[model samples]
Target: MRDVLVIGGGIIGLLTARELRLSGAEVTLIEMGQTGRESSWAGGGIISPLYPWRAPEPITALSRWSQTVYPALTTQLLDETGIDPEFTINGMLVLDDEDLDQALDWGARHGQPIEILQEPAPHAIEPELGPRPARALLLPGIAQLRPPRLSKAVRRALEKRIDLREREEVCELLVADGRVCGVRTPKGQVEAKRVVICAGAWTAKLLEQLGTPPDIQPVRGQMLLFHAKPGQINHITLHAGRYAIPRRDGRVLFGSTLEHAGFVKRTTAEDKEALYNDAIELFPVLRRTPIEDHWSGLRPGSPSGIPYIGAYPGIEGLYFNAGHFRNGLVMGPASARLMVDLMLDREPILNPAPYALNASR
Candidate 1:
């Protein structure tokens, strides 16, 4: 029997397993498919929320804590696994001004640096921007990483430390005497003293036996990638609800569309066209560049966009570290740490009340 069993092989599960092993617990991670091939691999990997100032207080807390630790975590992973996650502080530029006041107020309250630019100022920051909007908001502290690289790095780090089970689907939770003792896999039953559901979009389905699971559902998001010059686009650019991310290797990722399609991971031509047009509008140079790839991933959506990171009210040995909606990458590390802290009854990094299983419900 393992000390802990983590369901899901995305970033959240991978990190949680790592944390548990570090705390001297025997951990086993099971994924329905290959690890890191889900939303963790499909995300753009912006280390901060899309608009940091606009996120709720709980999200803001998790994101801020994660940002502080990402540099060190990525460094350690690179040193141990020799796989660089390419953590970079490229900053971000927001072109919309509808929430300027709210953004400014939030930034001031959080002590986040925000610069309000006008006309030529915006163009000076990003030369590729076709024409400067009337005004722009520059958040110089934002950072980003290559999602695929980060996922690979984390998985590599966890391989030798834990019983990492890939392509093994956890079909059901084994609850005996009102306590989750282990999980039922296709092969057989695996026993563990404790279990955590980091199943992302499939979290709710896995917990269906327990009536009224956390209000989590799958929200589909599509993205388009373009091969451009390394320096073609300097910083992450956002306009309306879409944004363009420039990777270190000159690959620009433009996305995405939030749709309510159930378990359908297929990309649509309509979304591809819309993303391409939006990318061009954001950076005119993309007009000449051809799209290299197009894909979609299902994000675990919650009512408050806050993930649950504690034990179920009446269920023993069962915990959740899922339902992060769109900010999974930004909040993964902190969420994983918080989940482990709560499970072990240790001092938590942040207040656990906001992320309790019953908080959102």
Candidate 2:
């Protein structure tokens, strides 16, 4: 039997397969579509969730671990494959103050470098900003990486290292005597000692057949991209439930309407206009720049905004690392590492109790 079979080819599956392979396990990864073309590619690529201090403790822990390791990991990927993921530490600027008190206390408790800014600091930090915000928080440790480049780099690096299959969809899990043995696809049944479901938004469809589906639903997010000269925006500027992420290549990404649209990845004109309005509110100069792209993807939303990332309940040799919602890019690294630790029976970097498949919702 093959050592491991990873279903789905988003950032989570790719990284998990890479981790297992590095531990000397023979791994095979199957993707329904092209690798990294799902939610991972459609994301804004900010390494931290906007207003992270208010997030769940599990989310914070995984994101912090990912933030700590992303630099050296990206450097190694770039060295191995001639692809630069453009990992940048430009920081994050939160312009909303609705939850400022709670966020500040959380940051202080966690020892995060969250600075409360008054007038002039916002404009001084990012001159392109139209006006000073009512209240601001400067998270200097926050960073970002180009998601497409990072996905491509990892896929490229694993070309010869693992058995990567594309256009192969897993139809069902092969179970025998209450234990997962392999998976069934349209092509054939591939035998593996273990199976992992990293199918993102479609994970529910697969898990339901096994009678252990988690409460994962699809949340659609639409984004607009604008091309401007570099340095137009120095940091990831966020305000009023929207954000503008500027890539190093002069591309400013403005996103994202959170709608429970059920696998519909359509970008609407209304959302586009709304996103444009939000973007120009922060940087009025962007009003003059033409929008370059508009697109949408489905994020796997779990209960309480935390992903299910451990052994599948009541099933042996079946695992899961899906339902990360909008934080997939931010939590991918640590989530993958934790899954490897669980499958190998080793202690994880952080406590795994909070992220178990059957953890309290």
Candidate 3:
């Protein structure tokens, strides 16, 4: 029995439970598998703003606020758990003049610097991409966080307080009086006063069992991690919607081809080759970098690319914070902040309009 029962054990669920505990709510977190073993662990750990400057205001505001809160949040969680979560701030690089202008507009209202740069400037910042004639969008304030490490840190931090039920899949959602009271797992039922569904790609299926509308679908993204030279790229690079993230180690992470693969997690040779081809075209130096590994993860996508947040209409004491799509890591912390405010009756940081639960398909 607890004040809140959080479904799913990914980053969003973990953060939501942590914030609730901080606000004096007793939380019980149930994970179908090992905590953070799914898409959360597989993410490239990018805290990004959307491309083409087409993000809605709510998502934009939430992401910007999460940027400020994440460093501090990671620090506090690390101190409490004594584990470094590996959150790095190397900023980002978006090449091409048109993309640069769009990046500037996205950062302009948020006070985050979006600098347009020429050859010398990119050289000064990166010092590796030599003789490149492309214009660059320098997002100096952007950062990255290791989703796996941070998720582990969060689980460890909440271990002493929250009742973590891992490897125990919930088979049913218990509703004694047509209100979310407890979840039925294979092991047993865990009762709670309120429930928040934070399952990432499984969000739609999870809610569907309870006769609820869950507007979430899986968008498969294939990413590759490479063992490469260090300091080769100073910032995360984006060209033609493909991107790269440099690790603290010599390994450079290149990613992500978005496809509607429908829960099929296998990597296609064509997709992998396409990413590699794009890497060579963008940096050219990656031609020497050997590809070590490639993998894929599914993001829960919604109709408008915005997540399904807030309370479910006609469902008392039940809430949703899923469907984050590609920006799950960037939006996780801020989404939790909003969920906490709505659950605890605090003034929300952003207007609760764009992330409406009853959004049309």
TM-score of 3: 0.94
Estimate the Cα RMSD of every predicted model relative to the unseen true structure: 1.0, 1.1, 1.9
TM for every model, in the order presented, reads 0.98, 0.98, 0.94
- lDDT (C-alpha, whole model) for all candidates: 0.91, 0.90, 0.82
Better of 2 and 3 by lDDT: 2
Candidate 3 structure quality by residue, lDDT tens digits, 139-158: 77788877889999999998
Against the correct fold, how does model 1 do in TM-score?
A: 0.98
TM-score of 2: 0.98
What lDDT is reached at residue 255 by model 1?
86
lDDT tens per residue, model 2, 1-361: 8999999899999999989989999999999999999999999999998879778999999998988899999999999998999999888999887788898898888778888888777888888898755568899988899999999999998979888989998887999997999988899999999999999999999999877798899999999999888988899988888898889988999988999988878989898898998889889999999899999999999987899999998888999999998899889999999999999999888899988877896
Error of 1 at 336 (Å): 0.6
True-structure Cα RMSD, model 2: 1.1
Error of 1 at 7 (Å): 0.3
Clashes within 3 Å, all models in order:
0, 0, 0
Deviating ranges (above 4 Å) for candidate 1? none
Model 1: colliding residue pairs: none
